[model samples]
Target: MARRKKTSPLEDVLDLLAMLPWWACVMLAAVSYFLLHPLAAPIQASDIQGQGGAMVGAMMQKAVIHGLATAGQHIVPLLCLAAAALSAWRRKQRQSLLTEVAQARNTDALDGMSWREFELLVGESYRQQGYCVAEIGGDGPDGGVDLVLAKGGEKFFVQCKQWKAYKVGVTTVRELYGVMAAKGATGGFVVTSGRFTEDAKEFAQGRNIELIDGPRLFAMIQRARQTQGPSTSEHRESAITTGFPQVQAKASVTEPTANSQATTRPDCPRCGAAMEQRTARQGANAGNAFWGCSTYPKCRGTRATG
Candidate 1:
């Protein structure tokens, strides 16, 4: 037989606490005292004679009524205090709940930061993308290209710029390119939150340099999240996309023959659209096989067969 699950001791304690019914018990006791105490026989009868023209019995009855009224006055404040204390405690709990929600949202924002904060947001996205990154900051004159990154046997020089409003121009891309060549690096990436100027984009093309703009960066971050699975802190995977076309590889084919028209197309296999294909030069597909989608960019579905 399956082992029985053990009951939690804390759950029992909470049940006992709920059963106390402190307010109900206090009210019941107060009301019982008020009603029962008045039921006692009066010290003197209505027929009893007066001490000095005033009836002694009437005077005693008046005193008893006054005593009951006085008791009610004292009880009212105590009940109010109890109610106020309960309200305050509940309010505190509500505030704490709100605080936790806000913190979760903030963490998500950091993880979802555009490509501009690329290296810093590296923990979730790029790590899943097969890139390892190290964050660095100091008084260096290179304007914070401090993150060291590696993928496979190659090292990539990376610089992250978190500018949202202004466009990053040719100067930034040029600087990274120079650094890449100087270090004899395989390639380099300059990631930014905002758009790059036309000149900056032109400069990046054809060089061993890549520019990751806001949209691409956001998409990659989101994809990384999906690849990793669900998480309690979605902030770490904030870049994961909710509704968008599937991601394509950086390069469709690593090698092609002089007359090879069988380039891998980015298409959807199911819908007959052009499918984006990513293949390494030395992979199983090597020289002859080419993958095409039944659906194009709209679907980007894929199928591969020998």
Candidate 2:
């Protein structure tokens, strides 16, 4: 059995935060600024009722929490807005690139494009088919797998190979299948602007892995142009309205403003939930710093750190 890669929990929280609707953030900011305004003065010890010092302390704590939440509300929404804007811009870029590739004449046209660009193009193709496309690498290298596509709650993995001359091998297809099972994905796709070896096609026969070579990709592209109408973004948003979560954004997270009231908790990479620093109290390396999911008790996601 292959050991799973160690992942951080903070990445999960970030994924959810980035997918937040812009209007939702704006409303939160408005509610905090107007309706839930913090107290002008916190309760002081002297303000306590006769023999009720605990009341004063409780009031003080409540006031402090309100102040922190209020301050954060002002800034967190703005950061969310910025993240949303960046995400929108990147989405447009990917859509446009896919549109171009889908209309191109032959494999030679894709030969000049980089592997990352090819992945984005293929992801857009899947997006056109109503699959929620999430690029694997947050704005950096895609590690190995290129894109993860989801539709109707079923996840499918994709690997794009832009090799012009060489034929894709059986090992590549088998690895994708392995990754699909490991990641709990329902299916997998390996696309290339080149042909696949006979052995590769044979290995993928019974697996839920679809292999697309140059010619087939071109045909799908032509069909897509003929039927493509509504933007994938709008479709995805509509799906979200029907209770499906918006998939991960293609852009890297925008750093929040320095000295702002925003909480800087990182999202867990594995579970896409908020993570906080924690220390082991009774383990072998007790007192070591690591990351754990904030939604603990429910989510057992954790990540070790240096």
Best by TM-score: 2
Tens-digit lDDT string for candidate 1 (103-186): 342333433343423334533344345444443331245544645455434566667776766888999889877877777776
Q: What CA root-mean-square deviation does each model show from the true structure?
A: 23.6, 19.6
Clashes of 2: 14
Q: What residue runs in model 2 are displaced by over 4 Å at the alpha carbon?
A: 1-16, 19-67, 114-116, 138-145, 162-167, 237-306
lDDT of 1 at 49: 60
Worst 10 residues of 1 by lDDT: 235-244
lDDT of 2 by residue, 180-233 (tens): 777787677889989999999889875667788988777666665565664655
